[model samples]
Target: MVALAKKKEWSLLLLLAPALLYFLIYHFIPISGMVMAFQDYRIFGKSPFVGFKHFRILFASPAFLQVLRNTLIISFMKIVLFFPLPIIFALMLNEVRSSILRKFIQSTTYLPHFLSWVVIAGIWIAFLSPANGGLNQLREMFKLAPKDYMTDKGAIRWVLFASETWRSLGWDSIIYLAALASISPSLYESADLD
Candidate 1:
């Protein structure tokens, strides 16, 4: 059986060559560079190993701790709060009867996902600008003072959440839409009958 398998697998090995090459070049080669994390990296001479030195510094630093805390809090909000939102959005969208409107909505929402962060930043900067910006203009109408949220630390976290949602909602919904599509329509029919 082993001999027969090896003989039959020769063509399969050839078929896998591109993927094997990609793994070696893209993944394994770059992963090998991670050894520098344990070393004091040097360009000309050999890097000297200083195990746990960087990690100790990272842990001891107040700024690093603050960054770490912010990262964890932001990650939790994005992952826990926002994760289920796309699935719900897709489900709600699936319920819509008008294909034209549905397509329009999907396209509009998905477009922001394709935009780069720099472009998004430019757009948001303009939107949130205190002087002659959209948000401030609206605020002025309501007799409220203009506020620049870009540099405000309190506003920064909410901005992250909002931008993350804006960027990912449509793209993330696609997977859930696919899952929804895979559900057999007969199951719904059966449920209706019951």
Candidate 2:
């Protein structure tokens, strides 16, 4: 019985080995790279040890501080201000009686989140490019000069927020949709009768 059980255990281990190795290579190995931020990273053998020098430089720089502030502002815009959007969308979507329109909205909202971040970024870059993007076309319509949002310091934050919203809207709205589905039809009926 023990001899037969040995191969069964080994077979299970063999099946799991690839996933375990993948996790170690991708997740655990990258953690060791955290030290590279402190030290001067080298392609050759020995990297010169510099403790907290990089961090000191990062903390002391005004540009870094400004970037940090921008990041927080973007996060707040993404999380707090953006939180209501899914609820609003779900409510609006609930009111959509035409099944075709509802499916179209759902697909448009959900599809972007499934796209690779690089692809999404490229699409956004092209859309916002000053040369002849959709946005530039709109700007031209309004007789306003086309601005390069990718390069513009002031405009980039809003671009980030917008891109994040596009990516998050579908997935976040799913929770509300699920809640809406679980709700009793009698409740809606009673509300309507009121």
Candidate 3:
């Protein structure tokens, strides 16, 4: 029994070796480079430490403050507005009796999560373009003036939120779906009887 346990331990360690090596090389080693943030970096010599000079300059700038405000707003919108959506989606999907239809919906939604951000950004730009974009075309149909959503400051954050929701919805709902699936049918049967 001890011999078998020792073999299993070695097997687990062998499986983990590549991931441990990868983090050591890529993540841990690169963290040391963050010291450059405190230094006036020079290409060929030992750089003098500037401490908080860069951070002071950044915090003093109005543009930096504006960017920081935008970041906070966007993050809040993403967290608050997007949190319930996946749970709702999972509930809806759990009610879907047809396996084919559920799978089709899952595949369609999951595809966006796998897409690179650059590709997603390009797709969104094309779809939101003022000239002959899908959205502008719909607006033109309704006799409304074309709105440049990509360039609009007020609409940009909502756009980011919508895009993030679209990319993450199905992938995020998978966890909730698994949880739902784990509930025994006997629980529902007993509830129905009650």
lDDT string for model 1 (13-111, tens) is 999999999999999999989989899999999899999999898889889978988899899989999999999999998998899998988888889
TM-scores, all candidates, are: 0.85, 0.79, 0.87
Task: List ranges where model 1 is wrong by over 4 Å.
Answer: 1-7, 42-49
Residues 1-194 of candidate 2: C-alpha lDDT, one tens digit per residue: 99899999999999999999999999999999888987898999999999999999988998997889888988888889899999999988888999899989988998888988999899999999899999999999999999999999889988998998899898888889878879999999999999
Clashing pairs for model 3 are none
Candidate 3 ranges with C-alpha deviation above 4 Å: 1-19, 42-46
Better of 1 and 3 by TM-score: 3
For each candidate in the order shown, give its overall lDDT on alpha carbons.
Answer: 0.91, 0.91, 0.95
TM-score, structure 2 vs. true: 0.79
Clashing residue pairs found in predicted model 2: none
* Model 1 lowest lDDT segment of ten: 121-130
Top candidate when judged by TM-score against the true structure:
3
lDDT of 3 by residue, 68-164 (tens): 9999999999889999999999999999999999999988988899999999999999999999899999999999999999999999998899899
| Global fold similarity of model 3 (TM-score) | 0.87
